[model samples]
Target: MSILLYFTIVPLGTAFLVTLLRKKKGISDLLAVLSSLYLFGLSLATAGLTKSHGVMIYKVGGWFPTIGITLVVDGLSAFLLVAINLVAFLVLIYAISYMERYTDKWKFHALFMFMLAGLNGVIISGDLFNLYVFLEIASISAYALVAFGVKPQNLEAAFKYTIMGAVASIFILLGIALLYSYTSTLNMADVAYCLSDKAKNPLLVFIWVLFLAGFGLKAALVPFHAWLPDAHSSAPSPVSAMLSGVVIKTIGIYALMRIFFNVLGVSINLLSVLMASGILSMVVGAFLAIAQNDIKRMLAYSSISQVGYIIFALGVGTPLAILGGLFHLFNHAVFKSLLFLDAGAIEYSTGERNMDKLGGLNNKLPVTGYTSLMAAMSISGIPPLAGFWSKLIIIVAAVEAGYIGYAIVAVLISIVTLVYYLKFQSFVFFGKLDAVYNKIQEVPLAMKTALVILAVICVMGGLMLTGTFRPFLEGASNVILSGTGYKQAVLGAIR
Candidate 1:
């Protein structure tokens, strides 16, 4: 069970070690990439182990739940671990070459590892206070990373992100405090066990509202999404990939799901609220994306829209719907990360992010062009790609749940998604090559390697719903479906 600690410790330690080795040439890169690779492999192994071993629990210093910090690696934890570490590893690889334009590349490596550590901790931590702590760690690192360029826009974006992130943290802390005062414990499983026995009241209702607002802000759901586009577009491309692909999912959606479904328990009212928010985010985000000329900004807005599918599916509260949500979560991480990296490569080669200023890159940057095309298609829900299947499942599940109106809106949004992505491909890759960019070369091998692997995943990702890969997603969905029974699983695992 101590293996859970490695996910946190290695990255945190590597972060510190990278800081010390900042002056050494290449050492920081080596350590950061190696640590990320190890964590990715370990996460994959943990996924396998959890599927075979059931839930595993680790108590710090031999203390029991409610008495000490506990770490758990259930199906959900392992599933997220794999997604987070895999994306981190790939982003680290992409950053190796992409970050050369900046000074103090080692600092980026350090902060990235810190964020990775925090993300892993958020998934594995068994208590609410620790979850908040880990969330802050990740949030703070992200704020700084967004400003890594120190450009005026980057500074402004980071400041806005810091302010919004602080507000969200405060909301989450206040909710945790109220929950603790009522239940007399912070261990999530114990809190759930306690809450299950108590009658619902006004204070609990207030707690739910607070937590939803807090996590909703972090997740950048509609009305709460002001910070995401700027923060994501201003950050380095690899950082953008991490932010849109895994960070929001981890500290935002993942936290929301863990608390609402497993610890606090879900209700019809809560589910309806989620559904409404999801639809709003979907429509608003897609329309905004269609209006963007900046490539990274468009992708950032697109992320908010794609995330809506996941949120809406989860809100549907059906078994098939939960499975669809989780599947789309995983698929979004892959294709979105790939799309951002492709954007970075284009910028790296031509120093242009405005789609209108770009054209005919297909022949010159074949790798970037084709990969971007694949990712754009996947995100647009084109058939036979990973994104299509997840979106299909979500739409099908929505109809099955008798939310025919929601399903219709989802289908409409998917069409809008395809529209903007076609705009992306047309303006950037399919037209006449700009004379200024004619001499620009493809990105370095490292960036292309990251893009190609992710593209391959986008192509093959549909297979996840079949064969051995299905269990990884199913296991995670089963955890959410289990609801308050999560407490019994954790406590029983401890025994």
Candidate 2:
């Protein structure tokens, strides 16, 4: 079988096998960690293969397009695979020690692997229905994970998230059904081929609106962002990291990009709407974050703001803008996950999540404090860090695209980002020691190890924009710039 298939299979197989071995002490952790490592290695290998071979297509049962399931690995898919699997591996390692407090650790690992399988599947799916299937898999896993603690707040948050998620899924399915009715094909390439010559009819517009609402909710853009702060804050820290770091990007932003750019093809009207939505998400999310005292809740709000940067950049529709968008996506995955993990560490040590109650922790929990500082600086776009470069690229691209007003909003919102994050730093790490937390120590070795690695990435992620790693971003950008020619590219690859 093709290596690309293993991205989905490995985690799925491990999830089930781990379930069967749940009664064995340490076996579930061993298998789960090993599975994540294998998938991370496979993702790197896929990146190399994609670089060498261009786009690749894996057919199931040797069936042709329109008759069977297919998985496509392009530069974009490879880029996301590397980011997703790398973070998953690190989060799994962190979970090993962090989850010791919870019972049924095996079930957590199983669900986590299941979520990873779903994420990989979504990234590679070549058909609309298949994408939905994987999306649901990931969504279901996430809902379960959100409520895994069974706390009152967790249960309430999970119920709210599930209701909203179900509505979004219905919208997406309705959109898919309408598109299939028009084109009579489930294959994404085939659907694009059929729609290529058609005019922008009301049916097409309706389908586009359905998709925008569905994927926009999944991406947590403002107005559709009601569930995010609650859901992300309520879930376990590692699960929160996965949700914000990769889940929203995978099933939400990635799906939006693939369908709008590659399938329906970008339109001026749609791009305008996207830009408007992004701007609102940026400004509104930042403001909400500023009022939050709960550490995880604030980070959850920050995720909405950061995602806005990506969506706004994409809406600009310039090659430079797209590059900036993709880069920010990667950087956000790194630093945001770092922040969430740090939040977890803080809670793990002191049992306090409210910023007002977490004063002067730096003296007691040096590792979490320092790593949190690095992550906060990066997310605030401090120079020489990964976040600065991507945010700069995006703003520059906006100005170049003649969207100066939007650029101004972005710049101002960036200041808001800095303000809230600094508040977070000051309250959590720099103030006088709260007597209650004076004796709290650093987190476990494994959690500390994950935080350090993610912080290192935050410091070094800018290298992707430099000499050797530049092509990885450029290659992914080129795929999107290919637009509806994606149909031709996929067809050629399969042939």
Candidate 3:
């Protein structure tokens, strides 16, 4: 239980400090930064421990067998916790300076930390009901974060996001109620164990549909993705980076993967559904992004497309495909965040985001321009970059799995991904300097630092699949591949 307490306490503590010392902005910033940094350290330490000791389980209230909640930190959960905290720490530091343009920076920081706590909680919770509660904690905070700018579009986006989120939550809760009624257990392992006794429950089929729709909304999968562009683009950039970078993965794909593959048991039919959704996202996201003039809007749509690739790979159900999907998830987190932060830096410097009005940024803001270019090329799947390696893995997985049609679609979508990134690069930073932007200054130092960190990661993320990090990624993927067999690992730990 120390694991859960440690992760949640740091953020909740920082929030208290923010509330108590509202007037001391500098002090609050320092406290918030330190809190996030400490949390990141905790996540890293957790990673190392999990590497050495394997899955760590903390039975809440010392209750055994199904009475209280359980927080299980396995390879997969540990990996995501580390990823979420890692980016959140950088984004928090970026927010310290980037948020200066707006008022009430401390409020932003507090809410941000709370949001992180909720995300970590969602990733670690081993019970369905507890997972829902943490999902709410993160979703509610996200709703407020979306409206932080207080612009009409911001408010509108937040309202839409909230309403959709509510609908999704209701669906999820209803499904949980159904499952609880059927199995009388909220703990995932208990439910799975009980489920294995029943050959296949019809109620489970219904619950599966509910979960797909509910988590689909969170993931911004194609049909359920209406509010993402407005909300992500309008929110402050750090929030945008976090939203696209890791939030969707945690709340949507990661949750879906866990419940389906580990808890409910994966089936060929479900894999088909996953692949179809993935393909739709890839094609549609790429096509729509090519038409947007707003810099952030375009990038938001692109995320929808790229995420499809990961979903599709996982759906393919081959070991190679799952590896590719997981790898892409990690790489996308880095480059996509960097891209959004780069957009933020542009807005900070020039106060403009329209591609039509942006030009010649390389001359005026060399760091932002160069860093963004690295991100663009990396995201576009240029050779030697992380994106290229992951994409190669996915395509190879598709071809080797004999999903030749999907492989063709994957290659085509990648080409499309490149087209848009090149368009973004040429239009925003490489052409004649927009005459109107002559007086613009470079991005604030803190923002530049975050961008640089992400850019370097974008370049090096591929290395993760090759060295010591290779085991980390493979181990986490193996947990998912464990499928219903996951019970063996958890049950063994409990014994």
Candidate 4:
């Protein structure tokens, strides 16, 4: 549908327009907020269309899929588009107030919208080269945003991030090139169709390794996660929310899912590797988070651990496992963003991020504190909340898949997760009111509005598994479960 074009066009157009309006105060904010809101609504509409129409393919310039750019939306892409745009809209709202602490808010808006365009493009892109291009656009924007503060530390973090990101891009590009070389086509469906006829070979195995290394680094899976803590902690909080919440998922986990499960197809060896990586990330991230005093840094590490849950669940490759993985992906986007925004609110109020230096903020920033608590509880997998249900699904799926040992590890890591979050809650919100912060106030209204909306999602997110909402997650999981049928679906749609 033509509407698919708006996903990238609106954000790209807004980025350019906002840059042109540098002289108009508040105009950039107005445009950015309105564009994001529009995109969020558009994404929801697209999700509805995906539900009604199944897979929809839009060939650019009305050309055939083999020679033209194609933007496709199936249940999976529609689900991710909704998650990505919803989070982007909320993050933009929070940024309006929080970004006032920095100069040239217009520039921030421009880069943010630019990043959003890349993210949306990556989701809808139906070819490999365009996927890499959009991935780099988002990566470059993130690199600049990380250094927006212009601090020595911020620049250092951005530099490290850029280097690591470049390395990842190279690996991904090489994988794409190899795949194209083998298949003589860059269209995802065509590539899969070609691969289906070829016998499994060592070259395909090498390509899979290249992709796993590349996307694994992007996802911040353990051992490839060196850049994440610095990048997330150094960037603005709303940016951190985007990075931890959806950016990593769209460019990293989502790409892995599409390519591994849908394109190249999964293997026993691939599943084993994914499970190992996910377990390592879970253990390492939780341990590292426990040692952090910086709130953002701790939350950054927490993102790695939570991402592990999704990756591990997906690795199990059961229907229930895929459902849990996708659900947790959505839940993480909500609660993790909420947590980071709360951290931003704390910083806005007291200019402190060290938990040791912040205490009893609940009295001063009640919305932030309680919301943080709710997010904390939910992310810790407490009962009846979003995080709990997803985690429970994962654990049950693991047991059913006969990975009892891995299931036990997941439970232990969850307890570790609870410990660190409680530590966070106790250190930042539950202690006696500090004398230094007595006069500090809550964050501005826009920031508070974002936090509350996310908190409500965390509270209600469990309903996604029931009644009307069940189809959203189920639809996405069905896409992954379809295997090579995805190629047939896309090719058939084109004909």
Candidate 5:
């Protein structure tokens, strides 16, 4: 219970205190930083405990079994905890320096902390309705954070995101209601258990459609991805890192995998649909991105493309394919966040995100230039970098699963990916220096620290595919692999 309460307490506590004294402007940054550090520590402690033992269950208000809202710390939760908290800690470090340009640093930190709480809560929660609650928490904070800049574009993007997100939430809620009505249980595993032997209902297909629509919007997959570029590119950099990095994975793709694989039990038809969409997103996103001059906008389009690879891998549904998909998910989270943060750093220094307006920064903004280069290479699947190994596995798995066409497409996109990245590097950092950026300096220490740490992770994240690190990706994959046994795993672990 302490573990679950930590989520509620830390963010609520921080939010309350921040709101009360935010007007003071004194000691707010210190308090904000301290609160985030503490939350990071808590998540780490939770991770160590889960890795050492097995799942940890906390039932709220003394309710037992399927009757209560339960927070479960199984392999899936633990893996997300590490990824979310790890990125968050680095984002916080970056925010310390990155947020200096924005006013009301305290309020910014407060919103950031609340966002983390919502994300963590969404990951750990075992109850379907509770997941909705946490999803809203994260989404609402995100809506505000996207508009944190209060610029016309920021507000417009935030408005668009809010409307789309609200629609998605309604779809999810309606699906939950249908599930609750059919199974008479709000608990996920319990619903799965009750459904384990139940005859197929036509309602399931309907529910699947609803879920696909909802989470697809959340994940920003191709057709549903229209909102992502505008929103992600408009938000502040640290917020951009968080949104592109963890929020979409936790609230969107992660939930989709959990429900489709574990709870709903997807069919071959479902997988075919998944693979087709993945391929479409991969090709379309990459093609569109190559023409963009807005660096952040380009990255946003690239995100859609990369995320397609994960979905395609998952659609293959092979062990190695799932491994590749999950590996790519984590690897993408690390380097993508670094890229966004680096973008933020450059924007902070020069107040420009237009690639054509900037150049020759390799010398002046060494930290931003090199770190972003590493992230670009990692994302483009350069050898020995994190992106290459996961991508290799995904392509291999696609071939293994007899999707040679998909494999060919994935490979081609890798080349396309490299092309756009080179274009970004050439236009943003390698060409002649822009006269408007002459006096820019390196970002503050805290932001630099964030970039360096994430760059190191980008260099080494491929190690996650290896022996000791295998458990993180593998254990999380097994949770989905054992989708058939999912009901048993959760029901058996009940108090």
Candidate 6:
């Protein structure tokens, strides 16, 4: 079997086995960790393979393109795979100790693996219909995971998320149906080839609107962002990390980029729309986050804002802008996941998430406090951290593209990001020790190990832009800049 197939299959097979082993103590956790480790290793191997071999196309059952399902791994897919799996493996490691407080740990592992499978499937799918199927698989698993706690708030958040998610799915399906009607092909590359000659079609305009709304909602961009805060805050911390770290990027941003850049091709109008939405999300999410008392809720809102930076960078539509956007996507996944895990660690120790109620945690939970400090610094675009480089690239790209107003807003909002994260640090870690948390202690070894590892990444991730890691980011950027040439690239790889 092709290595690409393992990305989806390993998680799926593990999920099923975990379900059967639910009654066995320790076994489920062991399986979950091992599976995640394997997936991370596979993702790294795939990246190396792609770097050496270029684009790879794997057809299911020896069938030909347009007739058989295909998995295409180019630079973009490889980059996302590595980001997703790396965060996932760390999150799983955190979960091993953190989840001891909750019952039915096996079920959590099972759902998590299912979600991983869905994410991997989405990244690799070359068929539009297959992408939708994998999207649903991931979405459904996420909804269940969000409600895993079965508390009133968890249920409420999951319901709201499901309603919004179902509507988005409908919009995407409608768009796909219309595109299929026009082009008579479900294969994404073939659809791109068919659409290239019909640039002026009015139906194409309608399809674009549908896809934009659908993907925008999934990505939690501004007006479509109501569901994110509640869901991210209510879900388990590890699950929240997964949701904010990768789920939005894979199902929302990645899908939108694939459909718009590779299939419909970039246009001035589309770029403008993306830029406008991004700016709105960046400004609005920041302002809303400032008022949040819940640490997780603040982090959730910050996600919407950071994602805005990414979308805005992509909308700049220059090679540098695209590179910055992809780099930020990876950086955000790392630090944001770290931040959420920190939030979880705090809650794990003190059983409180409201910043107003928490104080002087650094004395009790030194690892969590310091690691969170690193993440907060990184997210705030402080120099020498991963976040600063990507944000700098994006702001410079905007200035170069003559979107000076957008660049200004990005800079101002970045300061806003710093303000709130500083608030988080002060409220949770720096003030007088709360009498209530006096008995609290540092989290377990597993949790500390995860936090330390992610913090180390946050510190050094910027180096990726300079040395041996440069090609990984550049390779993904090249794919996006290639635009509709993606069709030729995929077809040529197959031939």
Alpha-carbon deviation at 345 in model 3, angstroms: 0.4
User: Each model's C-alpha lDDT?
Assistant: 0.95, 0.94, 0.89, 0.94, 0.88, 0.95
State in Å the error of residue 2, model 2: 0.7
After superposing candidate 2 on the true structure, give the runs of residues whose Cα lies further than 4 Å from its correct spot.
Answer: none
- Model 5 RMSD in Å is 1.4
Give per-residue CA lDDT, model 1, range 383-467, as digits (tens): 9999999999999999999999999999999999999999999999998998888689989999989999999999999999999
Question: What TM-score does each of the candidates earn?
Answer: 0.99, 0.99, 0.99, 0.99, 0.97, 0.99
- After superposition, which runs of candidate 6 have C-alpha atoms over 4 Å from their true positions? none
- Compose the digit string of candidate 6's lDDT tens values, residues 180-232: 99999999999999988775788989999999999999999998999999999
Cα lDDT tens digits for candidate 4, 1-495: 899999999999999999999899999999999999999999999999999999999998898897988998999999999999999999999998999999999999999999999999999999999999999999999999999999998999999999999999999999999999999999999999999999878999899999999999999999899999999999999999999999999999999999999999998889988998999999999999999999999999999999999999988999999999999999999999999999989999899899998888788888999999999999999998999999999999999999999999999999999999999999999989889888998888999899999999999999999999899889899999999889999999888
lDDT of 1 at 306: 88
TM-score of 5: 0.97
| Residue 397, candidate 5: alpha-carbon lDDT | 93
Collision count for each candidate, in order: 0, 0, 0, 0, 0, 0
Quote model 3's TM-score: 0.99
lDDT, residue 45, model 3 = 88
lDDT of 5 by residue, 1-495 (tens): 467578667877877888888877556667766777777787777767767766678878888978878887777777887888889888988887778788888878888878888998888888999999999999999999999999999999999999999999999999999999999998888888888778999998999999999999999989999899999999999999999999999999899998899888879999999999899889999999999999999999999999899999989999999989988999999999999998898888888888888889988999889999999999999999999999999999999889998899999999999999999899888978877778889988988998999999999988887887887778788888888577777777774
lDDT of 2 by residue, 1-495 (tens): 288789899999999999999999888889989999999999888888888999989998789877898999999999999999999999999998999989999999999999999999999999999999999999999999999999999999999999999999999999999999999999999999999878768899899999999999999999999999999999999999999999999989999999999999998988899899989999999999999999999999999999999999989989999999999999999999999999999999988899888788888989999998998999999999999999999999999999999999999999999999999999999979978776777898999999999999999999999998898889899999999999999998887
The alpha-carbon deviation from the true structure for residue 288 of candidate 6, after best TM-score superposition, in angstroms, is 0.4
CA shift of 112, model 4, Å? 0.3
RMSD of each: 0.6, 0.8, 1.0, 0.6, 1.4, 0.8
